[model samples]
Target chain A: MDYRARFLVDPLKKLSLADIDPDDTGDIDKEKAAELTATYLQRMEEDQFLLYADGRQSLLVVLQALDAAGKDGVIRHVFSAMNPQGTRVHGFKQPTPLESAHDFLWRAHAHVPAAGEVVIFNRSHYEDVLVVRVHDLVPREVWSQRYEKINAFEHLLAENGTRILKFFLHISPEEQLERFKKRLDDPRRHWKISESDYSERKFWPQYIEAYEEALVKTSTLTAPWYVIPANHKWFRNLAISQIISETLDEMGLELPPTRVNIDEIKAHYHAAVKATENKKSD
Target chain B: MDYRARFLVDPLKKLSLADIDPDDTGDIDKEKAAELTATYLQRMEEDQFLLYADGRQSLLVVLQALDAAGKDGVIRHVFSAMNPQGTRVHGFKQPTPLESAHDFLWRAHAHVPAAGEVVIFNRSHYEDVLVVRVHDLVPREVWSQRYEKINAFEHLLAENGTRILKFFLHISPEEQLERFKKRLDDPRRHWKISESDYSERKFWPQYIEAYEEALVKTSTLTAPWYVIPANHKWFRNLAISQIISETLDEMGLELPPTRVNIDEIKAHYHAAVKATENKKSD
Candidate 1:
C-alpha cells in the first residue's frame, strides 16, 4: 500500500480529525508491523548513508502531536536506525525571552537542515498555529495569518532542495489517559509526567481544531503532512518508517563520481610490492 | 530638507544609476555636516536608550555599495554614536562551504535583529542579486527570482516590528578608481585592497544594471531603499544619519512604564538613612 497517499491530508476534501480513527491499524497486525519495520529500517539506514555521501540534498521530518501521542517513541524506534552524524532533532518548548524577541520562525530557522543533513522537528513551527492559537498566546488574526507564513516558509525550504515531511501523530483521548496513567505507575516514566500533561488535556478539542486547520492550509506538493495512527505505537513506527524509507528512495541518493584513476593507483601498489621484494633480496 | 525624501528610490518612476551624480552633495558642506552630525548623533543616542528600554521594536540598516563605497566608514562614523551593547554589524563576505549549501538568504536571515536591537548589514543579501547576477554565479533564471524572495524576506522582517532601511551608496567608477589609487598610495589602507577591486571595476555597467533592477524590484514602503551619493564622505554620513535619526524619532520610542513605586522605595531609603544615623549615635 502507498502509505504516502493513504495518510496524506487531502486538501480538496475538508478533513475532520474525528473521521480518522487513531485505533485503525489498517490491514497490518502488530506482528506483521514488527516484521515489516525491520526491513524498512534496514533500507532507511543504507539510504541515509547514500544521502550523506551525495551531500547535496536535505530532509526535514516534522512531527506534531497531542500530549502523550508517542512523538519521541517514533524518533527513538525509527530515526535511531540512521547514523547520528548527519541527523539532528530539535524539540520546541516554551520560547525564551530572547527567542520571543524575534519573529516566531526565528528560532526554528536557525536549526534547519544543511546539505546532506536530516533534521527532525519533534514539535515544530506548527505550534505557532497549534498551541499558540489554542492557548490564545496571540490574537486570532495573528495566528490566522501564520498558515500562509508557514506555507511560504516551507516553500522556501522546498525550493532550496530540502524535502519536507510532516506527520501529525493522531491519538485518541483514551490512549493519552492510559499513557499518563502508565507514566504515574512507572518510576522510569515518572520524569515524563508534568502538570501540563493533565492541564493541557482540557484543550484537546481546541488543539484538534487548530491542528486540522494548520494541516489542511499548509499541506502542499513540496511539503506534505501525514496523519499517523499513533494509538498503537508499533503501528505508528511501521507506518512512519515505511513513509520515510519510501521518501528517501525517491530522493535518488547516489554517491558522487570519483576523479582518481584506479589503474594508476593499482600500478603504485605493484611498484610498492616490487620495492618490498627488492628489499628482501638485498 | 528631508533626507528620506531626497534619497529614497521612487518605485513608480524608473531609476537609472547614471543619472544620479555621485558627487552631488546637496546644500551640505563638510563643516556643516560635521556640526549637524553631532546634533543628530545626540538625539539618536537618547532615542536608542528609549528604544532599548522599550524593548519591542528593532532596526536593520542594510548598506549595499561597490568597492571603496565606504560601508565601513558609515558604521565607524555614524553608528559609533549608539551603545555597542545594542548595536551589531555583520559584513557579508564569500559564503562558507556550509553557507553555500543552504539558500542564499540563509546566512543573512540568521543575523536579523531581535527586539530593541540595532543591526547593520555592511554588505547584505543584496549581493545574491548584485554580485551573484553580475558574474553569472547562478543561472539568470535563478538569480532573477531572488528579487521576489528578497522582498518577501524584508516584508517578513518589516511586519515583525523590524524597521528596514537599505542604502545603496552611489559612487562613480572614476571615484572608485581614485579610492583604489588612494589605497595603493597609502600604506595604512594597503590591507583593504584586493585583486577583485580592480577586476570587478571592468563590470561597472553590468553592476549598475543589476543594482538598478534590484532597487526597483525591492523598494517598498515598509523597507525603503535609499540611493545615497557617496563621493563626499561627510555628505553621505550627513544624509544617512539624518534619515536614521528621523525614522527613529518617528518610531515613538517611549520608555516602558516602571512597575515599581518610587515613593515606597524613597521611604525605605530614608528609613535606612535614619538607622545609619542611630548606629552612628550608638
Candidate 2:
C-alpha cells in the first residue's frame, strides 16, 4: 500500500515524531516559526473583517487531529486577533441525542458560515468516517460510503460561496503520550484529559488507517487538507496561519467604503443643542 | 410621568467625568474604578470557564444604549479577558429580510447562550421597540406590545436556566456629539462612526420616549435593567463586571473534579508503548 493507505493500518502508536528524520529534509526553527505564525495570524485577522465588510464570501475552517495534538491551542492562538463580530468557533464534541437523530451532516450543516463571516469546526463531519469507522459505531458499509458524502457536501458548500480549509495535525504516538502525561501532571491541563481519550488510544491503529483512507478520498481542490507536522507547536501554527492568510488573500476581498459625512453630523449636533435649549426655556 | 416614562421621552445620554459633580457626591476615584472593573472582569473570566466546564447555568447579557454611548468599547474592553471557549458575543445589526419577517424576539432567540456559557448582545431584542419605534419602521400597534413580549420572553429564559443582565448606558445628548466628533478626528477611529448615527440623532426625542416607556414597562425583577451612568467608561465597566461576577458567584459553580486513576493511566501508557514496539517489529 502507498503512504496514504499505509497510514490506515499503520497504528497511531507506530508513528512518532522521533521516528521522522528532522534534519534529513523539511523543518524550520521554532522561534522563526512562531514569529512568522504570529505575523500571518495578524494579517488573517485584518483580512477576515475586511472580507466581512465587503460581504463577498464566507469561510469555514475544519481542524482534525489525534488526541492532545493542539486543536484547542490552534484556535486560541491563531485567530485570537480577529474581531469576534465576524467569527464563530464551534467545538464539535460527541454527538448529542438531538444531533445523533439527524443525518451525520445535519449538526455540521447547521453551523455552515453565513456570508461575510468565518466559522470554525474544531472537529467536524469527518468524524462520521473516522471515529464512526474506527469504533464500528456505524455499519461498515454505511461509514465506508460517507467519504463520497463528505466530498459532495464540501463541494456543495464551496460552490455556494464558502471557502473551506481543512487541517490534519500529524503527530507521532510518542509525542501524544508525552502530551497525555503532561495533561495528567499539570493541574491546569487536567480538565482536557478524559477516560474517552484513553479508550480511543487503545484503537490507535484503526483510527490511523481510517484517517489515511479518508484523506485521500476527500482531499479535493475545493477543500484540501494540509497535513501539518505537529511535533513542534510553533511550526504547526506558522504553517496553518500562512495557509489561511494565503487562501483569503487569493479570494481578493477589499474593505468597504464606509466614510462618514462630517458637515452633516456637525449641523445635526447644533440643531439638537438648539432644540434642547428651547425645551429648557419652556 | 415618572423617571422611567420621562427617560423614554428623552432617553439617557453620557455624563462625562468632568460634567459629573464629583465633589458634591459619593463618587469613586477614577483609578480605583478602573482597577475594580478590571479585577472583577478577570475574576469573571476565570469563573465563567469553570462553570462552562461543569455544565451549570447559562448567561445572557443584553446591552441597550443610545448611539455614541460606548456599546462597542464595553464589549472590546469589559469582556476582553474571557476565554472564547465559553463566551460568545453577538452584535445585532439592522434586521435582515428574514429577521424583519419574524417577531422581534425570534432573531434573538436563535442566539441564546447554552448551558455553562455566556452570550453578549451589543444591541438586542429591544431594538424592535426602540429603533423601530423611533424610525416608524413598524406600526405603533405592533411595536407597542413588544415590551410585554420581551419581558415574557426573558422570563421564560430565566425559568429555564439563563441569568439575564440588561444594561442601559445613560449618556447625555451633549456628550454624544463630542464622542461622534472624536471618531472623525482620529483616523484609526473612523470605522466606528456611521452616517446613520447622524440621521438617528435627528429623532432623539422620539427614541428617548420609546426607551423610557420600554424600561418602565419591561424592567422586571427576573431580568432587571441596570441604568449605567455612561460619562465614565471606567465606572461603566466596573459596574458591569461587578454585576456579572456577583451573579456567577451566587451560582457557586466550581471546576469539575479531575479524578482519573493514576494506576489506570500508567497501565494504559505501558500498553500504548508495547503496541508501538510490536508495530515496529512487524
Candidate 3:
C-alpha cells in the first residue's frame, strides 16, 4: 500500500484515532522494514545534498506524539543520516517564562528551516492546541481559535518554499504504558519517564480528540499530516523515512545553474594553478 | 607541534600579519595533512555525541576572515561531520535594517548555542570591529571602543557555560587574489567572486591593521583567537578540526544521570511489557 495515500489525513474528511491501528506494519516483517528504511535513508541523504546545493527549498518535519511515542527515536534513527551542515533539530520543551511572554508561535517561527536546510521540530506550535487544550492551560476562546491560526501559519511557510511534514505518532495507550515501564526497567532510561506520563494517560481520550481536530483542520495539501502507526518502533521509522524520501525526491531538486562563463573561468583557473605550481617549485 | 599551541595568539604579544606565513603547512605534505584531518574529524564526531548526550557545555566557533579567506569552505568542510541535531550554523551577512538598529552584539547573542549544542558563526560580531573600522563606516572613536565591549560580551558567555573558539583565517594578499581569480575561473564559484573582492583588495593593509589590533586587544583566557595560516586549504582544515576535537574532548562530558528510581521502575516496566505481549497474543 502507498503509505502517503494510506496515512495522509484527508482534509475534507474528519479524522478519528480509532480508524488507524498503531501496531499496523502493512504485513511487512521487521527485517524487510529495516531494509526498506535503510534504502529510504540513503535516498534522503542524496536528495538533501541536492537540496543544499540548489540552495532554494527547505524541509520542516514536525513530530507530535504522546509521551513515549518514539519522537526521539524517530529523530535519532531517521534524520541523523542527513548532513549536519544542512539539518537542524529543535526540541520545544515547556515554554520558558521569556518564551511565554510572546504568542505561542513566536519561538517556533524563529527556528523555521532556512532555504536549502531541513529542520525537525520534536514538538512544535501544535502544542498550543494539544497540551494547552488538554490541561486547560489557556482559555477556551483563545485555544478554540488556534486551528485557523496554525493553518494560516503553515500556509505562510508553504508559500515561502518550505515543505512541511507533520507526523502524529499514533501509539496505543497500552503501548505507551509498556514503554514507560521499559524506561523504569532500564536505569539509564529512567530520566525519560516522568510523573506526567502516568497522570496524562487518564486524559487519553481527550488527547485523541484534540489531535483529531488538529489533524483534520491543519492537514492541507501543502503541509500534510501523516498518522504513522507508531507502536512498532521499527515500522514507525520505516514509514516516516519513506514518506520524507518520496517528498524530497518529488521536489526535483537540481544543482543550481552556474552563473559565470565556464570556459573562461576554467582557463583562468588552470593558468592560476600553473602559476602557483611554478612559484612552489622555484 | 600542537596545532593549538602553534596557532594560538599570545595574549601579551602584539600580532603582525607579516610574521605569520600563510602558505606554511608546518612541514607536513598534503597527503599527511589529509590523513590527520580525517582522524581529527572522526574524533570530533564522537566527542560531539557525548557533548550532546551530556547536555552541559555549548561550543561557539567564531570564524572571521577577509573576503575569499575560506570562511564558507571552513564551515562546510570542518563542521559538517557532527550530528545536525546538535549543531547550528548562522551566517551574519550584511545586517538587515532591523539588525542594524541594535547594538552589534545583539544579533550575535540571540544565536549563541544552547546547552549541549555547537554553533558556528560564518562571520560574527568581530566584523563590527574589523570591517566597520577598515571602511570607516563608523568613526574611529566608535569602533575603537567595541573591542572592550566584545571582550565583556564573550566573558558573559564563558561564565554561562559556552566555550568559545575564534579563528581569524589568516591568508596573504597574494593568496586572496589567487582565490578570487579561481572563483572567477570556475563557473560554479562565480557567485562567490564579487565586486567587493576587487574593491576590498584595496583595503588589504587597513584590514590587516584592523585585525592586528582586534587580536591584541580582545584575546583573553576564556575566548582566545587562533590565527590560522589559510593559504594551504588542507592544512587549514586539519588545524581547525584538531583544535575543536581536542577542546571538546577535554570537556569531560558524561551521559546525564537518571532522575528516577531505577530498580522500582525496572520491575514495573517488565510487568507492563509482559502484559502488552499477552494482550497481543490474546
Candidate 4:
C-alpha cells in the first residue's frame, strides 16, 4: 500500500476518525514490517546527511497523539539511528507564566529548525486548538480564530524553506486503556502514568472531534497531516519512517556545489602544509 | 599554554590591540599545531554528542572579525569535522528593513541556540556597537548605550543554560592588505572581494577603537572575549579549537539519567517482541 496516499487526510473528504482502522497493518506481517522499517531508517539517515550537506532546506516533524498513543515510542524507534547533531526534539508542556504572557505561537517559533536541520515537536501549537478548546482553556471564539493564525504561521515557515510533516497518531480508546493499564502495572512505567491520563480519557470523543477539525482545517499542500493508525506500535513506526524517508528522498537534496576551485584550494593547502613543515624544522 | 586563560581578555586591564601580536603562534610549530588542532576537533565532536545527549546546556560561539581577518576560514577549518546538524551558523549582515524597525538585538535574539545545541554567529549583536559606532550610523548617545544593552542581553542568555564564547579575530592592517591582494589576484576568490573592502579600510583605526571598547565593556566572566592573533590562519584555527574543546570539557556534560527502571523496560521490550512474533505466527 502507498501509505502516504492511503493515510494522508484528504481535505475535501470529511475527516471521520471512525473510518480508519486503528489496528490495520496493510496485510504486511510483523517480520516484513520490521525489515521494511529498518530499510527506511537507514535511508532516512542518508537522506538527512544529504539534507544537511545541501544546507538550504529544513524539515520539521510535528507529532500529535493521545496520552498513550506512543508518540515517545515512535520518536525513539524511528529517529534513534539518525545523528543527534542535526535532529532536535522539543516537547511542549503546559505554558509557564512567561510563555503565557506572549502570543500562543511565540514559544514554538523560537525553536523551529534552521537550514539543514530536522526538528521534531512532540506536541506543538496545535495544542492551542486541541487541549485549549476541549477543556475550555480558552473561549470558543478565541480558539476558533486560531486555525487561520496557525495556518498563516505555517505558511510563513513554508515560504522560508521549512518542509513540515504533521502526524496525528490515531489509536482506539480501548487500545489507550490497555496501554494505560500496562503503565500502571509496570513499576518502571509508573512515573509516566499520571492522574490526568485517566481523567483525560473521559474526554476521548471530544478530543477526537477537536483533532478532526484541526487536521481538516490546517493541513495544507505545503504542510500536510498524515493520520497514522498507531494501535500497533511496530506499524506506527513503520508508517512514519516510510513517510519521512520518502519525503526526504523527494526533496532532491545534493551537496552544495563548490564555490571555489578545488584545485586552487588544494594547491594552497599543500603550500600551507609545506610552510608548516618548514617551520617545524626551525 | 592554557589557551583559554592566555587569550581571555582581562576586563580590569586596559585593552590595546597594538599590544597583541597578530602573528603570534605560542611558539608552536605548524606541524605540531595542526596535530593538536586535529585532536581538539575530534574531542569537540565527542563533547558535542555528549552535550546533546545531556540536553541541559548550550554553547553560543560569537565570531567577530574585520573584513579579510579569516572568520570564514576559521569556521571552515575548525568546525568542519563537527556535526553540522547540531551546529548552526548565522551570519548577520546589514539589517533588513523589518530588522531595523525593531531594537538592534531583536533579530539576533531570535537565533540564539537552545539547550544541547551550538550556534555560531559570524557577526552578531556586537555589530550594533562596532559598525554602528565606527560608521556613525547612529548618533553617539544612541550607540554608546548599546554596550550595556549587549551585556545585559548576553547575561540573560547566560542565566539560562547558554555558555557564551566571543572571539575577536585580531589581524593587523598589513595582513588585511596582504589578504586583499591575494583575493584580487585569484579569480576564484574575487567574488568575496567587495568594493567595501577598500572603503572600509579607511576606518581601520576607528573600528579597532570601537572593538576595543566593546570588548572591554561586554566581556563578562560568564561570556568572555578571546582576542586571537589571526594573521596566520592555521594558528587562529589551533587557538580556537583548543579554547572551545577546553570550555566544553569544563561544562561537564553527561548523558541524562534514565527516569524509568531499565530492568522493567528491558522485560517489556522482550514481551513486546514476543507479542509481535506471536501475531506473525497467528
Candidate 5:
C-alpha cells in the first residue's frame, strides 16, 4: 500500500493535528499490519546493501515527536534493521554550552549523511523552531527566522546527493497521558521518566501549535514531512518502513560497473593458474 | 566451541602464518558451524541492544584481509545483523592527497566508535605496517616505529571505553586463486574485480610476513587478534561471529538503571489523570 500519500505533510499544505485521528490505521487490515511491517523491514535490509554498493546518493531521515509519541520505538523497530555499515542515527538532546553558542544548524550540518550513507536525526534542527518557540528559549524574532533557515538548509542538502525524509509522530494529549501512566506504572521504565515529563505535559497545546507552524513552513518537495498516527505502534512501524523502502526504490540504486576490463583479468587468471600448476609438476 | 583460544594470537608470543593451515575448519562439524553461527548472530542482536542501553562501552572491530579473502562476506553475514543505529563500519582504501599529508592514523582516529557504538574498520591503520612496508611506501624507520605507535594508539582507545578486536582472514593462495576465478567467471561480480587483483597476488608472501609481524606486535590483552581460517566461508563466519558474541558476553552489557523515582512519577500521573477525567465529566 502507498502510505506516503496518507501520511505525507505536503508542501505548502496547512497541517491540523486535530484533523487526523491518533488511532488511524488507514484502510490496511490491522491483522496484516505486523506482517507488512516485517516485509518492509526485510526490504530495507536489501535496499541498504544496494545503497552502500552504489556509493553515490545518501539519505537523511529526520524524526520529530512529542514525549511518548514513539520516536524511539520507531527507531528501535524500523531504522535498526538497516545494515549498520551505512546507517547512522544521531539524537539531538538539550544543546550543550558548546552547541548553544553556534547557529542552530551548525551541529546538525556536521552529521548529515555522507554519500551512500543514511543518517537519522532524532529530534533534529526543527527543535530550534518547535521547542525553542514553545519554550521561548530564544527571542521571538530569533526563533521565527529559523523556519526559512531550516528550509534553506534542507534545500542545500537536497541539491547534494541527500534524499531527506522528515516524520512527525502525531499522537493526542490523551494518548500521551496514557503512555505516561504506563511508564509510571512500570519500574523498569523509570529511567525514561524525568522531571520534565509532567511539566512538558502542560505545554501540550503550545507544542502542537509550534509543530503546526513548523510543519506548514518547512515541509518541502525536497524534504517532505509526514505526520504519522502513532497511537497504534504497529501501524506507525508499517507506515515508516514502507515509506523508507519506497524512497530507497526511488533512489535508483545499483552496483557500480566494473572498473577494469573483465577479459583481461580472465586471461591473467588463466596464466597464473597455469604457472602454479607447472611449478607444482616440477 | 570456544574458538577464541584456537585463533587468538597470544600477546608477545612469536607468530607464523605458515604454521596455521588456512583450510583448517578446526574440530566443529561443518554443518553445525552454519547452525552455530546463526545462533551467535541472533545473540549479537540482543547483546547489541544491551550495549546501546548501557551507554558506557564501545567495540571497535578491525578487519584486515587480503583481497578475495571474504571481508565483505563476513560483514554482510555477521555484522549487518546488528541494529544500524549503534553499529558503524569504515573502510580504509588508498589514501587521498589529503589523507597522505597527515599521519597515517589521522584518518582512522576520525572514525573510531563513540560511547555505546560498535565500529568496524574494513581496512585500518594496520595498513601502515602491512601495505606501507610491503610497497616501501615509507622508509624502514618510518614503518618500523608504527607497530608501537599503533599499540599506543589502540591502548589509548582501550583506556577510554573502546574494546578492540582484530581479525586476520587467513586464506591460502589456492583459495584466493579460486575466488578470483569465480569472480572472473561471474558477470554480476565483475564490478568487484580490480586491476590490482592480479598485480597484488605477487605480494602474497610479503603480505603474510607483514601480517605475521603486525599480528604479533599489536595483539594485546586489550586489543586481540583472531586468525580466522577463511578458506571455508561458513567456518570463517562461524568463528568471527562466535568470537564477537563471546566478547560481548565478557563486556557485562546491561540496560542502564532507572534514573528517576517511580513513586513520584506515579503521583503526578494520578493527579494528571484525575484532572482530565474531571474535565470530561464537566
Candidate 6:
C-alpha cells in the first residue's frame, strides 16, 4: 500500500497526524524554503507589534492536535520571535484539584487574552467537549451541549474585541505511532511522552470523528477553525504565520511616534566621558 | 550630585524603566565574568527543571523597580535561559477598561504560576496601590487599605504552594535621569521615552517613601521582598539567579524515568521503517 493511502486519515478514520505523508513533497530547495519561512516569521512579528499598539484588539490562538503533531515546535519556532512584552502563552493540562472545583471554563477563561495582547492556548477550553465527549468522561447529554456553549463563548469573546483562531493540526494514525516510538527511544524526549498519551492513542478513531464534527459545527466567521495540514512541519509553521500576519495586517497600526531630546543626551554623554578622561589624567 | 542619587525615585514618582543599568559587567575579567554569569544561569535552569519534576510547587517572581532598572533586560537575558515548558511571563501595564472595572487583583490572579510552573510578573498587583496612590487616582481610603489587602492576597498565594519572590531593583536617581536622556537621544529608543515618564520623574522622592512603606509592611517570610543592588547589571542578575536557584533546589525532583516496552517498540519501529523503505524503493 502507498504511504499516503495507508497513513492518510479521513472522516472514516478521522483526521490524525500519524496518517499523513511526512515526506509528502519529496524535497524543496533549502535556500528558498528558508527564505520563505523567514519572511513569514518576520511578517508575523511586524503584525504582532501592530496588534499590540492598537490596545483595542485582543487575539486568541487555539492550537489543537494529536500527540507529536508539531504543536510545541510551531509555538517555539514561529511565535517565539514575538516580543514577550506583547505576547503570552498558556498551556492547558489536566484540571488541578483547585481548578476541578470550579466549572471547566472558569480556569481557562481567566487566561483569556486582554486587549492589545496575543494569547496562545496550547490546548484550551474545548477539552470539556473533545476529551470529555471522546472518552465518555461526561454523559452524552452534557458533552453534546458543549458545542453550542463553545460557539456562544467564542461569540462573546468576539463581540468584546477578541479575534479567535483555531487550528486543528491534521495527522494520520500511522504517523502518530512512529512519532510515539521515537519519543520512547530518545532519552531527551522521554519526559514529554507520558503514559496517558499512549492510553489516549487507543481512541484515535473516536477523536478524529469528534474533531471533524466540532470543526464544522463550531467554526464561525468570528472564530474560525483553520484545518492545517500537519504532515509537513515547515508548511504548518508557514501557514500559521500567514494566517496571523493576515489578521494583523487587517488591523491598521503604525509604529509609535518618536521623541527626540538630543541636546540633553549629548551633554550627559560628554560629561561622563570627560569625567573618565579627567580621572585618567589624575 | 551623582547620577544614582539624582535618579533615585521619591514617594510621588511613577516607576519607569528609563534609569535601569543594561551593562553585563564590563570591568570584570571577561572570562571570569562570563563563567560566573553562565554558571548562575545554568544553576537556575537546573533548579527549574527539578521544581518542574516535583509537579506541585510553583513560583511567582514580582519585579518592582524604578525606570531603567533593567526589568526587561533581566527578563530577556536571565529568564531566557530557562526551559520554556516550565516558565511563563506576564508584563503588567496600565489597567484596561475591563481590568479597571474588576477588583485590583482580578488581572493578577489570572496569571498565577500553575503547579510546576514559574510565572514572572514584570509589574504586579502592587500597581493599583503604588501608581494610583502616587498619582491620587484613587481616594485615600480605597488605596490606603490596599497595603493590608496586598499582603493578604500574596499570603493566599503562598499558602497555595507558590513561593513568592518580590524584587525591588535599587538604582540611584541620577543614574535614572542619565538613562532617560539617552533614550531621548537614540531614535530607536525614542518611542519608549514618554512625557508621562518625565512628569513622574519630578516626584521621585514621593515614590521612594511609598516603596519603603510597602517593603516594611508586606515583606512576609513566605513571600519576602529582596532589595537588590541594581546599579550593577551583572550583580543584579547574579543575585536574582542565586535566590531563584536556592528556592528550586529546596524542592526535590528527579529526571522523569523513561519507560518503554522494548519488544513493542522494536516491532513497531521495524514495521514502520520497512513500510517507508519499501515505498521509497518502489
DockQ values, each candidate: 0.01, 0.32, 0.29, 0.06, 0.63, 0.19
My TM-score estimates for the predictions, one after another, are: 0.51, 0.81, 0.83, 0.58, 0.94, 0.70
List candidate 3 stretches off by more than 4 Å. A13-57, A81-87, A98-103, A114-117, A138-144, A171-193, A197-206, A230-238, A252-282, B26-39, B49-56, B172-182, B232-234, B274-282
| Model 2 alpha-carbon drift over 4 Å, by segment | A1-34, A96-102, A139-141, A186-193, A258-282, B1-38, B94-103, B136-146, B182-195, B231-235, B257-263, B270-282
Error of 3 at B18 (Å): 3.9
lDDT of residue A28 for candidate 6: 48
Chain A superposition TM-score, candidate 4: 0.95
- By summed lDDT, the worst window of 10 consecutive residues in model 6 chain A runs over A1-10
- For residues B1-282, what per-residue lDDT tens digits would candidate 6 score against the true structure? 122223333334444433344333334554565677788788887778777876777989999877788888788667866765567888898999999899999999998998888889998988776787788998989988888888899989888889998888887766676677667666656556665666676566678767777766677777777666677776677667766776666656556665655556556557766766786789
Q: Could you tell me which residue pairs clash in candidate 4? A: A85-B85, A85-B86, A86-B85
The fraction of correct interface contacts reproduced by each prediction comes to 0.00, 0.24, 0.33, 0.01, 0.72, 0.19
Shift of residue B98 alpha carbon in model 2, Å: 4.6
What tens digits encode model 2's per-residue C-alpha lDDT throughout A1-282?
022222221222333433443122134576766777778888897788677877768899999988988887787778666666677888898899999999999999998988899888999999999888887899998998998899899999999889998887778777888788777677775665678878877777787788777877787778876566677777667777888887888887876554766667667667866877897899
For each candidate in the order shown, give its overall lDDT on alpha carbons: 0.83, 0.75, 0.86, 0.85, 0.89, 0.72
Best lDDT among the predictions, by candidate number = 5
Candidate 4, B104-182: lDDT as tens digits: 9999999999898988888999999989888889999999999889889999999998999999999987787667667
Q: How much is the lDDT of residue B115 in candidate 6?
A: 82
TM-score order of candidates, best first? Answer: 5, 3, 2, 6, 4, 1
Chain B superposition TM-score per model: 0.96, 0.83, 0.95, 0.95, 0.95, 0.80
Q: Write the per-residue lDDT of candidate 2 for residues B1-282, one digit (tens) a residue.
A: 022222221224432223332122125788877777777877887788777877767899888888888887787677656766667889898989999788778999999998888899989998888988887888999888878788889999999788888888877777787687676666554554677877788787677777767876776767776666676777677767787787777777876676677568768877887877898899
Candidate 6 structure quality by residue, lDDT tens digits, A184-268: 7776666555556666776777887788777766777788776766677776676677677777777665656655355654565
Clashes of each: 0, 14, 5, 3, 0, 44
Label model 3 with its docking quality class: acceptable
Ranking by DockQ: 5, 2, 3, 6, 4, 1
What's model 1's lDDT at A95?
92
Cα lDDT, model 4, residue B37: 91
The per-residue C-alpha lDDT of model 3 at residue A213 equals 92
CA deviation > 4 Å runs, candidate 1: A1-282
